[model samples]
Target: MKRNIVIATLTAAALATGGTVAAFAAGDDETATQRQSSAGTQVVADRDDADDRADDVNDDADDADDREDDADDRTAVATGDVDVTAAEAIAAALKSVPGTAVSADLDDEDDSGKVVWDVDVLGGDTWHSITIDPATGKVLGSHTEQEDDTAQVRAALKGSSVTAAEAAQAAAAKGAVTSVDLDDDGGSRAWDVETRATGKADQDWQVDLNSGKVTTDRSDDDED
Candidate 1:
């Protein structure tokens, strides 16, 4: 009977300490929740860091592409035999002729080993070919076959349905025009155009004055 009484007294003491045990358990649960929240925050931060790294990679690729394009532009400027760009050469030629520039090409064949820009201009009813030194942007000389070629062009236009401007536009499809001339292709009339390239020889394009058909010629010989 005495032992049972002692055991009952201990059970009473434990019941009186109920709030302390519950407080300790609540504190432990709160700590565990805080640790879980910290881990979740760390995971979010890691995802953000990953996203930032991917963006950096894309930015680097874009920068590389821009650099490559700039290098290509520089290479194109350096490959020309003349120091002047095609635009500058054309502008100088137009200042001398005051006409619509049809074509401009670098000609490295001067006897003095100097490079010149051969520009063709269409002004009024005549076509003018002006040569300019690329280094100085100075006019070297100019010539025109207007008297002879104009008469033939007029005669051909009288019989053809297509206009001169249209024929030139058709021929320009082959490439940039270096020179344009009117000539007889067998019995039919045609417009012969030479197209300029950066590193290659001028290409020949023929536009049929009557049909407005454009054709290419592989030969280096002039159609005249």
Candidate 2:
């Protein structure tokens, strides 16, 4: 009777402190087992949700990277008429002259109508003109264009950061870059780029070296 009275007093104190007492014997606790199962299920569900979210983020990142890579590819080789790209032509020219490429033009106006990439490189005091096959990307021929005009070309290229390949890429929006030239037209030195399409007339653009900006330039049709 005394032990029962002490237990009742302890129960009363617990209740007064807003505490509830619970006890479950091992191997005989169905309610506790059910609570543990429910908690395990909730944890699994949360982990699965986090994993799904991470997969979605990775997928999005992969898609974005693919799009950027595609854009870069298009910018470099969007011209469908020729297989040899401006960048390739510039690289070929550099291999021959080991200098800075100043101009590259895709020409098909020869007597036999052979398509070739004409690349001009500035090597020290000489300007080298290199010709490469459009289909094979092989160097066909090379010649010295001029030796005295290096000073003029150098002056025009001073403080210029945009290269011939970069100028071609800038103008390769709707078509492939047909020609890129370092020019000082209109008193401002910049790169003059021409893009050619299949059925449309060629378009001209001026690429500024100081800021990598592209703008419409004087077109050949403007003479009319």
Can you give the TM-score per candidate against the true fold? Answer: 0.36, 0.59
lDDT of 2 at 221: 53
Q: Ten residues in a row with the worst lDDT in model 2?
A: 19-28
The segments of candidate 2 whose C-alpha lies over 4 angstroms from its true place after superposition are: 1-81, 219-224
lDDT of each: 0.65, 0.76
Residues 13-104 of candidate 2: C-alpha lDDT, one tens digit per residue: 98765533333244347778989999999999999999999999999998986666434334334444368878788887788779889889
> Tens digits of per-residue lDDT for model 1 on 1-224?
99999999999989868878888999999999999999999999999999999999999998986666534433434555346544566677788887655556555434344446677776667888889776677888998745444544455556666543455567655554444555653564566666555566547777776788888753445534
Alpha carbon lDDT of residue 29, candidate 1?
100
Instruction: List runs of model 1 lying over 4 Å from the truth.
Output: 1-78, 82-95, 98-110, 119-129, 133-150, 157-178, 184-186, 195-203, 209-213, 218-224
Q: Quick one: best TM-score, which candidate?
A: 2
